[model samples]
Target: MSLFLGLDIGTSAVKAIIIDAEDREQASAVAPLSIDHPHPLWSEQHPDAWWAASAAVLDRLAADHPKLMSGVAALGLSGQMLGVALIDAAGRPIRPAPLWNDSRAGAECAELDVKVADFAGIAGARPMPGFSAPKILWLSRHEPEALKRTRCILLTKDYVRLCLTGEAISDRADSSATLLMDTQAGTWSPQLAEACGISTGLLPELVESGEVGGTLRPELARRFGLRSNLPIAGGAGDNMAGAIGAGVVRTGDAYISLGTSGVYFVANDRFVPARGQGMHTHRHAVPGLFGQHGCVLSAASALNWVAGILGVVSIERFLAEIEAADLPPADIPVFSPYLGGERTPHDDPLATATLSNLRGAAGPLHIGRGVIEGVAFAIADCHDALIAAGASIGTIALVGGGARSRFWGQLIATVIDRPLLLPPLALLGPALGAARLARQASGGGLSHEGDRHGMTMLEPRAGWRPGLEERRAIYRQHYAKLPV
Candidate 1:
């Protein structure tokens, strides 16, 4: 049986999985990663750390599934999008990469809008601090020497691909989030590059998500105990890969992801950006398709925070306690899930998380329920924005770590007032999507019917409608009063 490997370079970890042609997972491994926050609102990681994590995971996979590793035909990579990985001419990182959650480029965002004419029209999104272009601009102003020495600027996963194949390339799905791509044209925008005081030559070459980026280098292959000629598929950003993994390829297919961040992602057959409203538009991993998403900086992370605050040893335990308490929805306090700032509908990086109207009687259970409700409301905010932008969201596939919670899934459905479809193994969506891309890059045809196996559905409870609506209104009131 032919096998494909998928590597995900995520914000907090690196995960790899091996899957056979029939999409059966043979083996998988993950390595934890750390982010450096040297300053407020700054998230950075060394590119070499990503390489180390990738190597460690690959080593584990090779050890556990030697047969699968040996027969692996192609590999695909996915990662957090909008990060800036600056590499010098010799393919070495000049500095730690500014990650997607980094918000140190506020001034540069204003400058970019001024320097680049019609920036929104070209980039298909507002200039935000989390994007690659603003980080590049920040470097140009503060770290001019490093910017000058920069020979290539690649996204997170592309840098990993560089280490594996000795080539620098990126996919459209990742590049489109950079605020430097002419998203509609599927190319780098010279005007945006000039605004950042850089040249387009510094950007990696762009390709479709499933295209062959490069083959594994002989030396690197030997080090990892793999084939020398293994092809590396141009994988996608985490959102796009998650969509693919959920079988959301055609128009009107959408999903809500509740991971470190929360996202409302919808596939589009044509380019339609909601830049004015702070939503994101990027190319899909599948060719000739586009994706629009609204992102909230905190999702399940908020629940984890509540768990930690409650002194609970496990999130599952904390959630169970909250559910057992049977806290009424109307009594739940309001929480604004802006712990790491926010994206989508409000491009405010300085925004902080808020919990309001907590009664003296409220305790850990109340707070926990509020956190879940807050996250659901935040996602619903994005959903409303998407609908306003003319997205016809019918049924949403809920995917991510948070989807493991039946309580949270039901809450999201109630708050969003939409039917939620939970695919089997939803947490593995991004990895599975990467494997699918690898299969295509290795000359295999796409047939994701297997992806839909054992799907489950969650419909909104009509009885919960009024209470959720009241909670949403209160959230809106408190959100409006938040200090900008």
Candidate 2:
């Protein structure tokens, strides 16, 4: 009678859920999180806000389902990777955490490229402005006072873990993306930390994803109506944990996540840094496994932005109307999906999204279609980048809020020129993946393996290829000329 609770501290929100031993979800809750963009290329959030949201969500879960909450044998966490939360000696955040998509560290990234030898091969990524290490350097130069008080630097989910357990720790899966880890060794790199103007002492202790990080504190347990001293499993980064939720455990397994941020993830049995290809090489929650992924800063966020502009209340409804109208693809303008800059294939934080080739004949529907097409094309760029970096691809499972729209999923499939699989209950991916880690921590078998059911296979529709190829060419040309 084991129950596992998993929580994801995402950029947009915190999603928490509880699952029984049989892997069926018993209860779930979501609490929205807002990001502050005080300046261009800046994304920050207070660490206390994250804990407040998770605490409220968990307390609600306990209030609603006391039985399920009591049965929880262990808990797990998953979250956005590459975010840096600096905690003082009193376990208080010294300042707002810099988010993964924050690009203020571009100059710092350049300095690292010149500082670290074989930078890409060593870091398992190019010195991108969005990674945690560069951001720490940015803080060192821009906000030295905060760094002086910092006792530990934690990734997003690890920040939550510190709150729940009163321990400073992180797992390989999340820490690997911090650019302070030697990806192959699966350990923190003092050299990298020194380069970032920090010491390894500031990092959370590294653990395997399924390993027990710390027990739940008594006060938290009483508030959440769970057993005191319940072990907390070390959870992976959202994308890596999400790969688990999507059943992408084995080598060559792949999936696409279209959330606030879009991710193209592929599993590998061992570390294979696809450096300079704009992909992240990260540890999988599964032991001895690794994942390579590319990210687009905007995906459903881009779609939702257009929907808001068009005054559409329901996304599914709007997409339905677009599909019903059968809008001619060529009539749509080309859109660049870089609303918050880009990572995969571009790695350019200064890049801006664009909508070009607009004509008076183009209506809202046309603009909507173009936005959708542009996102799909950008994801395809992620796919192409990975392939050129020497990773193989096949059918990909779609995982995220976007999976609900067949219109969006099918369009992405057509753009990638590969079949896509949409798993049932796709939106629960990262949190569910965290729950799966909890299950593992509780001594259960790897239950997520090979249990594919109720998944829809999407194929590339024939009619879209030719017109999209021409459109994609224009989109690429637009990118070639874009920086503003």
Candidate 3:
């Protein structure tokens, strides 16, 4: 049986998985990665570190699962979006790459808004500090020398792809989020590049997500113990890959991803920009489709913070406590999951989290429940934005690390008041999606039968409606009063 490999260069780690022709996972591995914060509101990682991590994970998979590695037909990549890696003509990174969570370019964002008239209409989203364009502007002002030497600009995964294939190319799905791409046209915008004080020649060539980027370079392939002619798909950004992995290919198909960050992604058949409301309209991994998303800067990360504060040694234990508490609506505290600031609806990077109505008796359990509810409320805010934009949302597929908890799933269902579908392999959303893309690039057709199997559905409990409604009202009131 032919095998496909998928690699995800995520914010917290680099993960790799091998799947057979039937979409059954044969082996998977992950290597942890670190972020640098040299100054306040800054998040950067070395492009070399990403390549090292990717190589390490692939090395482990090849060592332990030789048979799986030997039959690998193709590889696909997915990674965090909006991060920029400046590479010189020699393909070496000139400086550290700013990440998606980086917020040091606030001033540059305003500059772009002024420099590029009709910014939202052209770029398909409002200028935000997390995007590549602002980061480039920041470099232009602060690190002009590095910007001067920069010959090619690549996103996170595309940098790794360069190492593997000796090519500098990115997919339309990832390019659309850069604030430098004409999303509707599925190409880079030279006009936007000029406005950002950068030359258009620096952007990587764009391709469809499932198209072949190139074959693995012979030397790298031999060094990594892989086939020489292995094809690499022009993969996607994390959220778009997650949507593809969840079979959210058609219009109206939506998925809620609760990774380190939260994303509510809806597939649309046509280009629909929601820039005014701080929502995003990005190209989808699937051809000819677009993805509309509302992103929360922190989702499961908020839960992780609560776990640390509560001194819970294991996430399992923390989740157990949440499942057991079952706090009634009136007793639950209200929380805002803005630990990393916010994106959708409110584009404030300085927004701090708030916990309200904490009684003298309130403890970790109440706070935990509140944190979960807060994330749900944030997603509901996004849901409302999509609805306001005239997008229809039906059953939502809930995927990611936080979706592992039955209680959390049910809570989100009640908060959003929508039926939720949980694929058995939901946690592997991006990697699996990347593998599927790899399969397609190799001229293989994947059967949707496997995707439709082993699914669990969670419906909002009627009993929880009253409590959810009451808490939602309080949440909205507090959210409005938050210091922006």
Q: List TM-scores for all candidates, in order.
A: 0.97, 0.98, 0.97
**What shift in Å separates residue 457 of candidate 3 from its native position after superposition?**
0.6
lDDT of 3: 0.87
Give the CA lDDT, 0 to 100, for residue 125 in model 1. 82
What lDDT does each candidate get? 0.87, 0.87, 0.87
lDDT of 2 at 403: 86
Weakest lDDT window of 10 consecutive positions for candidate 3: 445-454
Pairs of colliding residues, candidate 2: none
Q: Write the per-residue lDDT of candidate 2 for residues 1-484, one digit (tens) a residue.
A: 7789999988889989998776788899989899999998899999888998898899889889999999899999999888889999999999999898899999999999889987667668878987999999999999999999999999889889889989998999888888898988888898899999999989988889988888999998998999989999999999988887888877888999999889999887867776685787878888888888889989999998999988989988878877787877658799999898888888888788899989888988888889988999999999998888777765589998888888888989998889998887687889989998988887986555334777888889989888888889999997789745
How many residue pairs clash in model 3?
Answer: 0
- Global CA lDDT computed for model 2: 0.87
Model 2, position 57, has a per-residue lDDT of 91
Q: Model 1, 83: alpha-carbon shift in Å?
A: 1.0
